[model samples]
Target: MQTTAKNALVSELRERIQHLEGGAVRSRTVLPFGVPAIDSVLPSGGLAYGALHEVAGGGSGTVDGAAAALFVAGIAARTKGKIVWCLTRPDLFFPALAQVGLRADRVVFVESDREEDVLANMLEALSYGGLGAVVGELVRLPMTASRRLQLAAEKTGTIGLAVRRWRRQTEAHDFGQPTASTTRWRVSVMPSEELPVPGVGRGRWLLELMRSRAGECAEFLVGACDDKGRIDISTRAGDRQDQTSRSVHSG
Candidate 1:
């Protein structure tokens, strides 16, 4: 009789949970990166749609800024529909974005004269609900502005990316401030792999999940996006012997 009662209780609880999760499941859509090591650290094993995320470089140099831009572009490349890129300047190179799978034809670039205009355009694009993703580049993003962006994305089920670039080292510290983004990431360019024959191999990056609302934050050493905009763990990310042992064990 006790076993029977326990089984009934379990069934009742499961039903209640399913009822509660029905609406949540629809709102919390995900886009999986398909990399086990990286996905394991993120909630739902992927990046969340209907949310706003922030990405920044490790430093204030132009190269550092480019790394952050390309990283966001790669994410946008994997999304469906058209991509809207809003920036204060038109200095981004199209070839670099195309190499990461964000083709020129699929992207619409909006140049704004001021930072406020960039943020406004980004929020408007995210609210449209039809675009695959919206990316905004700004030197300073206040907490209130980020919250507005987040709310807009949640309402429209669109993905919003904020690329923070600073001209001075002191201004870079502003990135550490609080924001309403669902996730905050810092990407730094790493040395590319050296081929035994002649040319360079794929680029690598130190991707740091500085803050995340849905899961534990972590760091990863990952290769740059391939032709299809898919990322893979770097060959030198971990100890080779340890990886071999793990592979053998799993096998």
Candidate 2:
């Protein structure tokens, strides 16, 4: 049909634009999730390095946002070199980050009074390169701003993470808009894995891949925050199924 043809042309055009951005698809490094189920659906068989990725909590509450932030922490912990964390708030719990694998010694925190300052600092850190990753607590990631972030990452081979946290639920609507991020994710807290005895166990999360270029959307139920900050595949994953099909677009 004509509609399908139009869509194909649009897709091709986007690819061309991305290719011209100083990063071809094959030039970036890939970070595998280590779970076949999760990695299989990604276009690169893993998250691409030297790119910008978005992460937001499933809900507007602080708990949801914190979980999303911790997920990002775990990722940065696994990478090499130091991590630069730029944020508008000083409330990030260092002890919680340790529980997820990123220790204080490996992190450099940059505090800012404004969201725009935090984003500016993140862009600067990514441009510096040789760091593990640069993280920013963002309320809104405008398309133009995100493109700049992505370009900086691509040029420096650094990974950039925008952990979206908003003051109001209404502000969450902004996340629905498109960005130049290489990947977009939503993370929701789930029940902890059952333990052998009466005690707390490893946390669990329902991770949704909302948008990816040349990749299908997928949901993963996985155990969380190991000593090394990696979220392993939950044994319960087999019991669950994705509510949305692979063809689902941005949500």
In the range 1-251, model 1's lDDT, one tens digit per residue, is: 99999999999999989976863674578888888876766778889898999999874333348888988999999999999999987889989998989999999999989999999999999989888999999898899999999989987888999999876777888988898988888888877877778998888887777787857677777788876777877876342322112111100
Q: Of the candidates shown, which would achieve the greatest TM-score relative to the real structure?
A: 2
TM-scores of all predicted structures: 0.84, 0.85
lDDT of candidate 2 over 2-24, digit per residue (tens): 99999999999998898776566
**Alpha carbon lDDT of residue 88, candidate 2?**
81
- Once fitted onto the true fold, the runs of candidate 1 whose alpha carbons sit more than 4 angstroms away are 1-23, 59-64, 237-251
Backbone clash total, candidate 1: 0
lDDT of 2 at 31: 81
The 10 consecutive residues of candidate 2 with the worst lDDT sum are 242-251
Model 2 CA deviation exceeding 4 Å by range: 1-26, 60-64, 241-251
RMSD of 2: 8.6
Candidates' C-alpha lDDT: 0.83, 0.85
